[model samples]
Target: MDPVDSSAKSTPGSNGSNSASSLPGVASPPERSNSQSNKPSHIAAHRQSFAENQRYPPPSPHAHRHPSFTQQAIQDLLINPPSNRHANTRYAGRDWRDMALSELVPDEAKWADLDTSVEEATMTLLKNNTSNVVLIRKTSDSKTAISTFDPSDLNAYLLVVVGLAKPNEEHVAAYDEISKKAQSQTPISLREIQTLSRKEQLVVLPADSTLDGAIEAFGSGIHRILVTNQSREVTGVLNQLRLLEFFWNEAANFPVIDRLYGSLLRDLQIGTQQIIAINADAPLADALSLMSNEGLTSVAVVDHGLNVVGNISTADVRHLTNTTSLPLLKSSCMHFISVILSERGVERGRDSFPVFYVNPYSTLAHTVAKLVATNSHRMWVVESASPSPSAPATPLLQASHPVPTPAAAAAVGATSPPAPTILIPPTTSTSGPQSPLPGQSIAVVPSAALPGSRISGRLTGVVSLTDILNLFAKSSGLNPSDPSEQRARRRRSSSSSVRPTIEGGRTSVDIRR
Candidate 1:
């Protein structure tokens, strides 16, 4: 098929170029998957200690048994003192940590010792509104009173001083070491992102394409869609959310259908923004900024002609650099890739190359589930000739791929790795015929630069978030052998291959390479 013609223009309804950025529940109709796991109220492995034990115990080991004594010991001792013991029961009125000093020591005056009975000490404390026994003990020969609670710090009425006494120096050092270790333990990248890439094919649908028509063309249970022009260029993004917005807000408020749909489309304009682009020379920082800001799970990479040479997404960048430290921010956007798309061109990539493709229409629900299962934001929409989109939405259907359980994960090892979604499929054409992998940068180019630019020859890979992070942000020491590591690993890499299955949907993802 001809490479994506970025020059194709969008209609007025699109966000700018993306006209179908809509939701399902919000707008027009359609529908619906799943694992067998039941949703429980709480799924913790162990029980909670504080579930019923509501009282706070003291540091004393036997405090729980003598609860009554702990609560009212000072009261009894003060009211009725022993003959020989010094009655200082008034000291129990409140702990020093919970007292207000301003109310206790107003004007310094001659203080009596706390060597009297509880009743007498209580009267003196109440008279001065002071409950501090330390005051009576400290005399002219005692140490200085430089250690005082600052009133400003007690604005909350209660002050909890943790680590009141100096902690062990060794313990403090260990704590610091632990904190440093956790912050720096990032995932490491081993595979080249360009090794995994794929493409999506979208058909031009007439405004009147029936709900069933969309399903048959794409798959059974579809939600989000990308609207394109006659030439198959992206015009807008359409999904249940956009449709729901129109259904409840825009379309609902209007009395007529024409104005309602029009208003809804205008409001959710998805075309205004330019697709994110980055050159092969840019740093890894640029890709991070785009993902963090634009929230793009995967971004398309284009060269000077606005052509889609290759796509460098989050996964690609991850595999390029090491997230364990910091991303590589070298020269221009071109120098950014953690793992470069083969620098020697497609000739050197004969044994390995990136490929692009969408999930099969028959198992889209499973594909979407995989996307959701791993928090993957990318999936391809291919121009498949198979499976008609004529069925209605079936919400009860399970959208997961038919894969064995975790117990079977071991078998994947003995078997050959599954085919991956590589942008530049393996082909022995190292001759002068010339097939250069696309310039692999994970940022979108401006719309103005797309027209007439040759993106087809830029690169041949479309990397995912996991790939990029693994390469650029990951640390060493992490396990690198995952059966699922064939290509589709995302956000985080695993030691095993995964066939993620969404509950329902038509969009399926394939990791090329």
Candidate 2:
């Protein structure tokens, strides 16, 4: 496969060579800093907590038994949902239903111009502590974005450029020495980045749209909706995580859904047991390639012994933009993880790499809390297994040759929009796994299990933000499984797609080196 051609040829649908100098409302880019000490202390704290395996104790069984009137009112609102105009009326007429999405804009939201460099955008994400940077055109009056550039996009770019640039070279030699020489700094613009990105149109909701409308959008399988003001200028982004975080923080006010928080994941049938893992000893490039080809955001990192030691995410790919971190792509996933931790200040006393995992018995509320606290998108579901030491470690799927990462390969077709027509899959639907894993299905060597304990058992499954938000959608009468009721409740959104279609059994290809 050819390396990504970053020449000035215009990508389809992009405005040609628009300069970013005069874009209104575009924030000045932060100064480039290579100093490790300049990184945010809070980010370090969050990563440190994750590295330590901070687990939340489940709420007391009686925690929701007796609720205040306001709590009951909120619960009643959810259980017996009020009409669109009155959605928030039950909670003492707070008018949340009438409230505009503008009010929910996060303070740290970041934006970029199409002319912004990939390296600059990468720095913006790290310095601002944000996941995505909305890319807008320089000449447009309205802050309409062409696409959102994220860490995953950066990862896809680098993998194509560095990892797969020389396919004929030995894997060890190609990966180990590619970054050692002085590399040319190509100023790849955000416009080109969008051309190569997953072609999902931005889902925009007018800022004046009601909270209830926003809820419905999320329920309809739209992972994120851009909140644009009256001028059609992008102001904020609303996603499943922020919405769920709001619910969690205000649990006291919403009694109906609050009671469900204490239910164990197993009881609720929440999360999918289908998981994808990579050997810690494998090259980091292999993990990146695995995620790229599979359309995954994260993958669990396990040791040769089949014990999940930690996790490596496409988000971690952002760190590679720096000179100090890029060379590690050729290194083992385990070593790359260590450098990542050291940069985050978690290497102070930690020897073992940490992973975000939960047992099947963990409560929904606790899992949500950890996700919010750590700003993580997914958690592994593991169960204790005392595999005989002699039992060979779980085997990896093998391939005899090299496969191109998304960046190096020909443009794949755009994924379909979320379908508003189908019933949401039951939380435990047996849709075949999306990516490769150790053996068929998660190796669920179920031994004695403890709910909140930190045992690195065999990987069973994963729970994600999408899973939890879908539950909320179900409660709000959006994703009823019954065909009759589903038809009645079906309200199509321009941006919705069924989750199962995305994860439906694609053959798993091994990307391990």
Q: Per-residue alpha-carbon lDDT of model 2 for 1-513, expressed as tens digits?
A: 212222222333334443322222222334445774577788656654563543533333233222324677786554434322222433533534466777776534467777666555655665655435445556445466767766666666676556353222334453333223214333456655453334444678887787777776565445577877677777677887788877776665565567677788889887665456787669888888766655567888764544565678877775555332344566677555554544443324433335477777777877877788767878887767535243334322221122322221212233432211101111232242221111111111111121222337666678887677767657655552322222123222212122222124531212243
TM-score of each: 0.21, 0.59
lDDT of model number 1: 0.28
Candidate 2 ranges beyond 4 A from true positions = 1-99, 106-109, 129-131, 138-142, 165-183, 219-221, 304-306, 346-355, 386-455, 480-513
Each model's C-alpha lDDT?
A: 0.28, 0.54
Query: Candidate 1, residues 1-513: lDDT per residue as tens digits?
Result: 212222122333333542122311112212211231443546433454784333542232222222324436566455333323232344333322222222222233223232322122222333432212112222344322211111111110010111111223544553343234324432111111111112122233433333333323222222234443444433333433223222222222322221222222113221111224554334445544444233344554433322233444543332221111122333233333212433322336322222322222213223223343333444332232222133311101112122222212332444543322111111222121221112222221222222232213322222232222222111221332331222222222322223232224222221211
Candidate 1 displacement at residue 264 in angstroms:
25
TM-score for model 2?
A: 0.59
**Weakest 10 consecutive residues of candidate 2 by summed lDDT:** 437-446
lDDT of 2: 0.54
For candidate 1, the TM-score is: 0.21
Q: Which stretches of candidate 1 lie over 4 Å from their true place?
A: 1-274, 320-327, 331-454, 457-513
Candidate with the greatest lDDT versus the true structure: 2
